[model samples]
Target: MVIFGLTAVVVVGGGAFVAKRSYDNSKIVPTPITPEDFGKIALGDLYAPDPKADAYKAAAVTAYKKDKLKNARKGVAALDWIEIKDKGPGGDGFPQANFPPGSNPSPGSNKGVAKTMLSSFGFGAEQWGCLEKLWMKESGWNERAMNRYSGAYGIPQSLPGSKMASAGSDWQTNAATQIKWGLGYIKGRYGTPCGAWGHSQAKGWY
Candidate 1:
């Protein structure tokens, strides 16, 4: 009985070894890389050899003052799953590293201004919704957009929405003229196409 038990142990051990070897040989080693690994590649092997040190780091300091500068304020919003796609491989490559996704993209969100405009214009969800898309594409609501060629100008790409003179002459830098012409344009032809607004969504114009 002892000899039989010893024999069984050897057989089991041998079987396990064979199975492991076959499994190892059959498995395909994956060359796929993780975001961290890819990021390391991005900087070049020389920059961050020691992950712990992250040797190439910016030292923090206070009282920063500069003469010329451009800046924007970001907002804190719960990102939807779609944002993840934009931040990951699904997004056109992770957002420039360190910079978090959905960082306040502009100096201020247009939400409030848009809301006010909607109320003033008596625009319903669908109509103003179209207007919103138009401005977003026009000048990002710049309020100072100027076209070099056709000489179209202002936030709403007033074109000659400047003709909004009938509304009020401040048409040059007037958000009101721009908005008025934009609204009128939509009402006239598209009757709320967001005219170029819808044009922009379809062909990135307006």
Candidate 2:
């Protein structure tokens, strides 16, 4: 009886040892990340800072302050996505003429104002590029920009110019008013600056 009991104990211990070894071998080991993996990853996947993007943001903030623009109390609703593409057509063709005689020129004058207005409408910093490109193409960010061909006028390029009156009585002179109207128009029509920019990209107007 003692010999039989010893044999039974040995068999059970052997089985448990084999089972544990099998289980250990079956466990998954994670792969280590390599420097090459960064190259394989998507640009959007990396949280790396971009100097050029930061510069653009900084310029936008400066332009806003220069124009003495104020932020609206409201912000945009949650957006599902914002698409930004292309380096954008620079406002080269827009005339260098200054508005209000002594005011700053187009393109440079309204950068921060546009950014602020877009933010009030609930857009992210990523959308600033698209907005800059969109308005650059539209009116060159000049408050006095007048489209003789389409009868569009101001920074937002309101058709007939007077249409911006709903935003403020000083839409013709105030960059903030024009921007406010433009933001409202973009929100109403395209849902966001990126959306308006996308439409402008595809159809040549937003």
Candidate 3:
């Protein structure tokens, strides 16, 4: 009986030791938490708003916009001014002649008026050759020139003759008035006389 009791006590002690060892081995070790991570975890959110970071991002955006605006202003300041030449007929310009307003005029006289007026619309004498050629093909610089089929009229060959009335009441008879309307039309549509000439050359019409 003494041996049996001793054996039972040993068996129970061995089982207790195995159970303790298994419990120790199964225990989880916690990872060390950084101060920042602990704060986030304590707040129950992984992503916390950082005021300093937000301010830095906002400041960087504002600085980029200011730099972009400064460069734009510099670009604007670097642009060159366009020079406009003198007005009125005569002095080494093409088809040079002085014609009184009421005088009967020819194509050459009409060209004289056009050359003087070119500068008013910011064109140089270099543009006159193209202007002359364009009008010569369109209406031969005639104030009363008319297209029977298209109803285009005057030096610029405006589709309707009445369109020249915007320049003056005597658009039908006055070469200067017709030239003014024509130049204004050319400027609005083609930017320059040469541009109009180029379009006319390519398309057979300006």
Instruction: Give the count of colliding residue pairs in each prediction.
Output: 4, 5, 0
- Candidates' lDDT values, in order? 0.39, 0.53, 0.57
Model 3, span 125-206: residue lDDT tens: 9999999999987777776665322335578765434445557545556688889888887887788999989987875566
Off by over 4 Å in 2: 1-101
- Clashing pairs for model 3 are none
Model 2: worst 10 consecutive residues (lDDT sum): 80-89
Residue-by-residue lDDT tens digits, candidate 1, 121-185: 55666666676666665556644554322223455554332233444434444455456555554
Cα RMSD for candidates in order: 26.1, 26.7, 41.0
What's the lDDT for residue 43 in model 1? 43
Tens-place lDDT per residue, model 2, 36-138, is 5434232222223333323323332233232222222234342111112111111212112233655554466578877766667888899888888888876
- For TM-score, candidate 1 versus 3, the one ahead is 3
Displacement of the residue 99 alpha carbon in candidate 2, Å: 6.4
